[model samples]
Each structure stands twice: as structure tokens, then as C-alpha cells.
Target: MKMKKVQEILEAHIWAGEEDLEGEVYAACGCDLMSDVLAFAKEKVLLLTGLVNPQVIRTAEMLDIRAIVFVRGKEPSKEMIEMANHKGMIILSTQEPLYMACGKLYAAGLMCESED
Candidate 1:
């Protein structure tokens, strides 16, 4: 799915990297645990999390996951946004909680890929 579709599906507001909205995401992973994200995230995956921290950006960067949706209306700090901007990542925020956000994306055909 395209990042633009993910934004529309989640009713998300782009906080950064709007220019990259055309980017394609092969899968989506909704998790707040950075360790799990590091372990399971695949290339070009969209990350959905309520954990608003720089570490999330770092984790996404490490995995080359370019788009992130901050669920439950959680917003990242200015510094975090700056960090994401530097990494050329798309930062989005939505009023939907993590579960609903994930479900909406899944319903929109953004399924997660199995590690196997």
C-alpha cells in the first residue's frame, strides 16, 4: 500500500516527510515495543505505535521502515520530529488507538508479512 492510502485509512495527519507520501509500504507492524519492532519489522513496513520517543525513530531507521503512525492521538516531540525529518521518514498521528489503527490498515489490505 502507498503511504497516502495509509494516511487516508487512518485519518492521520502528517507531521513530517509529506513529500514522501508516494512511497510504497509492503506491510504494516503495530507495536509499541521497540525490541519487537527491531526483531520483526521488514523493509518498507509502516510502523504504528503509541510510544512517542526518539528511540522509535531510531528503531524505524534501523529497519528502513519509512512511515510511522503515532496511535491514540499520541504526538511526538519536536526533537523527535526533527530526528524523523533528518532520516527522511514520514511521521503521522491519529486519534485511533493502536488496535483500531492496525485493524483499519489491515482491513485496507495492509497485512503484515511473516518472518518465515
Candidate 2:
């Protein structure tokens, strides 16, 4: 699914990278543990987490994430948003809890592509 459609599913607000929203994301992984995020996320992934920090954006950059959704109404710092824009990443914020957001995306057919 596209970032716009994911945003609608989560009832989210565009925090940054609004211009860079026209991108595709096939899989989604929602977790607060940075280690798991780094290990599990693959290409064109939509990352949903409550962790708001510069490192989150940095990790997303490292993993080549297509977009980020800050769940549970959490918001990232201005610096983080700027960093995400610089890295050409889309940032989204939603009030839904992490599990709820992930569930919605999965139910909407944004299933993660496995290597099976």
C-alpha cells in the first residue's frame, strides 16, 4: 500500500516529508525495540513505533525504510523531522496504539513479504 492509504488507515497526520509521500510500502513492523526493528525490517517497509528520537530516523535510514508512523500520539522532535526530510523519509503520526496500528495495516492487506 501507499503511504497516503496507510495514513488513512491509521487516521494519522503528516508530521514531515509531505512532499515525499508518493511512495510504496509493502511490509510493516511495529515494535519499540530498536534491535528488533533493525533486524526485521526489509525494503519498502512502513515502520510503526512509539519511540521518538533521532536514532529512530537514523535507524530507518540504515534500513531504507519508506515511511515512519509514530504511534500512540507520540511526536518526534523538530530535529528528527528535519533529519527524516533530509534522508528523504516520510513521517506520519497517529493516535492509535502500536498494536492497533499494525493490526489495521495488516487487515488492510499490507502484509509483510517473507522470504519463504
Candidate 3:
């Protein structure tokens, strides 16, 4: 799915990398555990998490994830945003909780890596 569509599906607000809104993501993963992300996320995946920390950005970077959706109204820190911007990754935040956000994206045809 296009990042813009994902944003719309989740009612998300872009926090950084607005230029990446047109990018494509083949899969989505909702996880608070970075280890789970490392183990399962594929290239260009959309990461949905409620954890607000710099480590999230680092994990996404290592996995080549281009977009991240912060659920439950969680916001990334200034340093995290800067790190994401430096890495050219798009960051989005939504008021919905993690499960609901993931479901909405899935219903919109954005499947998980395993489903893909």
C-alpha cells in the first residue's frame, strides 16, 4: 500500500519524511518488541508500535523499514524524529491503539509479512 493510503487508513499524522508519502510498503507489522521486528519484518515494511524511543528508529533502520506508525497517540521524541529524518524514514502517529491500527491497515489490503 502507498504510505499515503496507510496514513489515511489509520488516521495518522506525519511527523517526518513527508516526501515518502508516495512510497510503497508491501507488508505491515505491529509489535512493541524490537526483537520481533528484527525477526519478522521484511523490506519496506510498515512498523506499527506504541513504544516511543530511539531504539524503534534504530530497529527500523536495520531492517530497511521505510515507514513507522506510532499507535495509541504515542509520539516520537525530538532525537528520534531527527534520527528518522536522517535515515530518510517516514514517521506517522495515530490515536488508535496498536491492535485497531493494525486491523485497519490489514482490512485495507496491507497484509503482514507472513500473510504476504
Best by the TM-score measure: 3
Q: Which prediction has the highest lDDT against the true structure?
A: 3
The lDDT-based order of candidates, best leading, equals 3, 1, 2
Tell me each candidate's TM-score. 0.96, 0.94, 0.97
Model 3 worst lDDT window (10 residues)? 107-116
lDDT of 3: 0.92
**What ranking emerges by TM-score with the best candidate at the front?**
3, 1, 2
lDDT of each: 0.90, 0.87, 0.92
- Give the 10-residue window scoring lowest on summed lDDT in candidate 1: 107-116
Better of 1 and 2 by TM-score: 1
Write the residue-wise lDDT of candidate 3 on 12-99 in tens digits.
Answer: 9999989989999998899999999999888878999999999999999998898999999999999999999999999999999999
Model 1, 38-96: lDDT tens per residue? 98888878999999999999999988888899999999999999999999999999999
CA lDDT, candidate 3, residue 66 = 84
For candidate 1, give the lDDT of residue 58. Answer: 94
Count: clashes, candidate 3:
0
The 10-residue segment with the lowest total lDDT in model 2: 107-116
Residue pairs whose backbone atoms clash in candidate 1: none
Give all candidate RMSDs, comma-separated. 1.2, 1.3, 0.7
Native-referenced Cα lDDT, model 1: 0.90
